[model samples]
Target chain A: MDIAILADAVERGERRAVARAITLVESARPEHRVQATELLETLARTGREAIRIGLSGTPGVGKSTFIESFGLMLVAQGLRVAVLAVDPSSKRTGGSILGDKTRMERLSRSPDAFIRPSPSQSHLGGVARRTREAVALCEAAGFDVVLIETVGVGQSETVVAELSDVFLLLLAPAGGDELQGVKRGIMEAADIILVNKADGDLKATAMRTCADYAGALRLLRRRPQDPDGFPKAMTVSALEISGLDRAWAEIRDLVDWRRAQGHWHARRAEQARHWFEEEVRQTLLAQLAQPKARSLMQSLSEQVADGQLTASRAAQDLFASLWPEMEQTKLPESLDATIDTP
Target chain B: MDIAILADAVERGERRAVARAITLVESARPEHRVQATELLETLARTGREAIRIGLSGTPGVGKSTFIESFGLMLVAQGLRVAVLAVDPSSKRTGGSILGDKTRMERLSRSPDAFIRPSPSQSHLGGVARRTREAVALCEAAGFDVVLIETVGVGQSETVVAELSDVFLLLLAPAGGDELQGVKRGIMEAADIILVNKADGDLKATAMRTCADYAGALRLLRRRPQDPDGFPKAMTVSALEISGLDRAWAEIRDLVDWRRAQGHWHARRAEQARHWFEEEVRQTLLAQLAQPKARSLMQSLSEQVADGQLTASRAAQDLFASLWPEMEQTKLPESLDATIDTP
Candidate 1:
């Protein structure tokens, strides 16, 4: 696997090569993971640029329809688009129903659009990790715009929001009273809220829902980096294709404003730091799941569950077992001082 | 230093002993942590049964007033009440204003009540861990009702929700439109919603707010373990002490219903499991903060922040350095199967 050659082909907008690269990155095999890292290093050096967007909504919110309409509009404007999804539920349900290629039939057929459903078989973190790598790949492949979609309303939405430059949440007109049904943290993460399915019979409801959301949003604390100072809510009909142009304009304005303010670069840097800490934490847990440690943890868990051992004590014992030297070695003076003070 | 004596005194309901035990648990010194764990283990063996409740609200919601009024009512019914708080802000602000002894003037002076403000200095998780231990100490001291209050809103409320049996979210009468200001996840965690400060001029507004909350809660999904199926909302006048008795009855009903249906034991087991995993993660992070690992992480973080290296690669390099054996060692067969499947 010559990563340099693959990186070169991906840079030249070779769709097949991009797909193969994504598959390699998503593989759980140890050797493949090593190679994937090498591939990413090469791709990173190419300095690919793309406007990344994260989109999310609850089930039955016309997320796929909205993405299809939104993606086609971008492609029509001569901007190559890529749609990637992060659906961890696919691991449990066997595959993602939300990001099925058939759902975006027209977008998938477009020459300027690349659609990749979530890697159907991975942990939530694994799926997020792969989706992030796929975003880099799409950028390297010369796609000017990349949209990352998440299914349902929970941590997946939060994860997508963190990885993308802008987060758009799709809601249906009937979701007005159901606003409470959506997680507040998810709503806060949205840079823009689009009331989808705002056509025909639902138009009146959608308009009312739009007003309700606007009022609701005003009461919430605004994100400091918000280009408009607050999250914007608007009505859109994915089926009728109304409001697509205005939506694009808002997204563009937000990106341009954030870039001008230097928040775009700062946010990416913060994201990098966040992923670093997350990876370190996950890697530590994986090591702990090894056989020797697993057995020890099991017994400790049983004791703790039975109220015979405290969780803190169990963790301390496991740490001692994993690294015997650490038990006797005191923290360095500099770090020790901070810990004591804290 | 004498954990046995402290444990015995705590079991005998000595208020001073209970306070001293909590202080020992909250200590950052490694030696004190060991003794605190020992004390908890002994206390656990005594089979202390108490109905643990977590109460949270944003600042200005009158959490202390409600708790004071509510606590005195329970004490009048021959119940011993203990109020413990988890406030990480205290570490930054130097002390908590939410759980200050002065805030609950009447309750603090009661012979049957014990009030412990959050430790003035500690991390969020550190405070939560200590507070959990304090809850056990309170139970050992024969308190039948333990109230764990969290200041303001955010992760602290979620942490408190996880540690308690029932979570009650208090709000002011004028908080109807401000509903969107509250985090959605926190609202979902509530087992009961109490509209406090409902008196005189605010009485009608509180009733309307209570109805609004009830309607909003109906739109949200209920927790599967909730004995009553959905959270109930009601208005209360803590200042006038009007709804204290009814609130206690509702709490008692929920607890009794859950215990009868076996959800109480199951929920506790799940909470224990969650804390076990949390402790393991935190302990690993602490170990990584040690002098040797700290220097390596700092350098890697700088590279990651500068965009010279991807977070994934940096984490891999760190993990390889920390556990060289993991690089070559295949996971144990049992764990390998699970890892491969995931």
Candidate 2:
């Protein structure tokens, strides 16, 4: 693999090269991981930037329709769009129903549009890592916009929101007051709430739902990073393609405002730092899963469960076993000595 | 310390010994920690079982009043009670308003009651570990009921709930519709929702609030482990010392039902397992904070923030450096080998 050639091809907007880059990053092999890292490093200096948007909705919320409509709109305005779906649930089933191109036939045919489904075999953390790397690849491939879509199940939406500049939550208009259906954590992470199916006979219901959400948002604690210090709510009919432009405009305004306030850059930096810490934690956990440590941990866990050993003491014993040198060193002064009454 | 003597003293209901046991567990000193573990192991087989309950509410929700009133009721029923307040916020300020014995003057003065404030120096994890150990100590000291109190300010409440058999969420009646003020995560964790201060002119409001919460709970997903598969809601006036018996009855019923269904024991086992894993992770994180790993981590973090290196790659590099033998060994088969595209 010629690193320079691959980087050049990706930067030149070669579709096959871009897909290959994503596949390489998503691979679980150690050597491929090393090469993927080198490729990312090589392309880091290219300075290609993309607007990252996160889209989420419950199963029946028509997330695919909205993405296709909104994505096509962006393409019509000459913006290159890439859609990356992160479906962690598919990891267990080893099949992703989300990435079928037939679901968005028109958008799939557009030369300016690229849609990639989530990797079916990876865990949520692994999928998130791949999605983030794919975003970088898309940017390097000259895509002006990257849409990260996720089902509003489990913590996948939260993970998607973390890597995105803007988070859009889609909801149906019926039974809008049933806010309990929406996890408050997801609501808090949302920057914009869009009431889908606002056209046709659902218009009145959609209006009421919009008002309901607006009231609810007012009662919620304000997000410090939001430009207005609160999330915005609006009604949009993705079927009719109505209000899509306004939604896009709102997203743009927020991006500009946050960028001007220096929050955008700061948030990205914070996210990067957070990802680094997560990687370190995950790697350490994986190391602890080795046979030697795993067996010790299992026995220790059993003792702790049976109340025969304290978890902290067991942890210390395990750590000492893993790194014997730590046991010989004097304990740090921060550890209170007076407590040893003997 | 004489582990056998201390364990015997704790089992004999000696308040001073119980307090000393708690102090030993809370100490960070290496020798004290080791001794504390031995003391705990010695006391582990005493078969002292206490009814553990977690109580949480927002500021001004009358948590102290409720607990004081409720604790007195339990004491009147010839039950010994131990109150462990976990206020992580107080750790930073080196003061705990929640555990002020003055706030529960009557209960604190009772020989049947024990109240321990939050430890002022440790982080939330440390405090939680100490509190858990203290719970065991209190049980050994013949306290038949343990009340774990925490402010619903952050993830601290979640930690408290995890260690308790039943979680009670208290809320004021005034903001009934403003469910946004109450995080859904906490609401979902609650086994019983109490509308505190439901007397005098606020009786009607409290009733309405109780109804609202019941409806909200219906809309929320049921916790799988709950025997009835849903949390219950009620109105209580701590100031008037009314409804405390009914609340206790509700808690007893839930505990009995969960025990009969075998979920109670299973949950405790799961919690113990979780604690062991948490301890392992926390200890490893502490190791990473040591000077050798700290400097390298700092440099890697800077590189990650600057986008000069990806987090995954940096983590791999750090792990390899920390365990040089890993570099020499062939990558595990679980780590796919096919990703080396070259």
Candidate 3:
């Protein structure tokens, strides 16, 4: 695990080195973490960049088929494609289904394509973090496009959206007015929504669903980051392989417009800062995760639940217990907590 | 200023003492906070309880009219009612409107009613926490009901839903199928969706909207907490005062059912624990809010944004810089962060 050698091979676009780099970043081992950071920092100096597109949909939404078609289209145009999945379901099931290469047989066999299954991650944050580093690795290895896929579930799409330049939401045909096709809270995060299975009998229904979402998107708050005519919906049949080119064109138009408006650089920088802040918060919380502190918190929670103590008082008690040396006046700092804008 | 006298007065349902206690809890001053905590602890021992109903709707959805008519109805039935508004907008606009007493002139003048304007707090968390304390004060003052109304905006409704016993979502009519009448994610948080303005020529439209949401809610996964026919949609008109009694009956049915199932106590305990955990997290964040630590974070954020360091490495560097005495291996505890179930 020579960091310099691995980084150099990754920079040279060697397949084995790229695979090994992703594995290193995904490792939870402390020694592997040290090497992974060094490797990422070394690769960062290479100054390579990629189009990071985040894709999400419900469980049976043909995500794999769409990715296969889209990845093959990009590969045909001489663009190197990398696909990564952020599925938190693996943490609960002890299994991974998304990003399965076997599901996208055609794209998996392409020389210009690289597909990795979702890591059996234990949480949304950990999975998203590893996938983000893998995206950086792909960029260093000269990939032109990195498609980050997240299964539509609790908070996963939103987390993946933070690391993407553009986000696509895939859907099946929605019923008239029910519009209950997609999960709640996700429409706001999607820049482009594609209604899949649009061929044959479902074609007309898909068209109607597209129009319905298009109308809903128009009524929702318009994001300042998007160019005009964006956050729109369109029909795409992955089975028919129709509309893929149009979707790609719209994606390019969006990326180009954001780049021209200076939003492209600003967004990535903001996302990086967001991750940094999240990591910082996690570090701070780790102190309370200690065994003694956790047991104390559990007892306090039970007492507060049983009405023996108020929530605010329980928090104050925990603070006192954790740090008896600190002054009583400092125990409840949130009473005077003030936000400082940066 | 005298805790014993004030607690006694509040327990006796004295108006002046109740108002004074709320102001004390809402104060950001360190001294007032100490007194507020002491007063709350004393009030807790009294064991007075009130039904907490959280109401949310888009502005101009006739929330003021509805609360006025509903509060008057309850007062006419020999029940005291307290109305509190949680408005984060006041933090930005420097103007309070939601809970203005004048908006519900009739109810405000009634001796059996209490109306408090939204506090001009600086952020969502602080505003909600203060409102929770105020609700406690009202309960101690012998109010039979506490109506917590939050203007439908951003994440305010969801936070209020956490504190509510039975959550109500007030929506206006929708078009044939747009369903864009309410906020995106707030629907699932609702236990009841009341189609307001169901009186005029718009009455037919409101009925249709109610049916649409009824279908949508059916499609949503049932919360194990709710019994049959719950999380349902109904049409109500505060202007006509026609549906007030029916809405009241439905609310009572749901509350009674939940109590019979033991969800009432469980829900309250869960809410208290939630607030306790939130307070602890805020306390942890306060440490990083120190001037020196803030400056360090800003520098690290800037470096990560500029791509001078990866987000993870920057977090590692911050940990090392913050605690030079601590072992490097011990600093990145989140690498092994595990969710410990209680």
TM-score of only chain B in every candidate structure? 0.90, 0.90, 0.88
Best of the two (2, 3) by lDDT? 3
Q: Provide the lDDT at B143 for model 2.
A: 92
Poorest 10 consecutive residues of model 3 chain A by lDDT? A333-342
Clashing pairs in 1: A184-B184
CAPRI verdict (incorrect, acceptable, medium, high) for model 1: acceptable
Q: Interface Cα RMSD for candidate 2?
A: 4.5
Please give, for residues B130-227, the per-residue lDDT of candidate 2 as tens digits: 77888888988889899999976567888888889899999999665586777767888889999998999999989999889988888888777775
lDDT of 1 at B308: 95
TM-score of 1: 0.84
A1-342, model 1: which lDDT tens digit per residue?
A: 777777788888888788888877777667777877888888887787799999988779998899999999999999999998887766433244343778998999898999888764655256567787899899889999999999853478878988999989899886556777667777788888899988999999999988888888888887778855458899999999999999999998999988999999999988878878777766666666677888998888887877777787787788888766554222222112111100
Model 3, A1-342: lDDT tens per residue? 578888888898876688778877877666877888888999998899899999998877789999999999999999999998887776432234333767998998998998877765544256667888999999999999999998866778888889899999999886875676565568888999999999999999999999999988998888888889999899998999999999999999999999999999999999999988987876667667667778999999999888899888888899888855333332232334332111
Q: State in Å the error of residue A13, model 2.
A: 2.0
lDDT (tens digit, per residue) of candidate 1 on B288-320: 767778899989988997889987789888877
Best by DockQ: 2
* Winner on lDDT (1 vs 2): 2
Error of 1 at B239 (Å): 3.7
Q: Supply the global lDDT for candidate 1.
A: 0.80
What is the C-alpha local distance difference test score of each model? 0.80, 0.81, 0.82
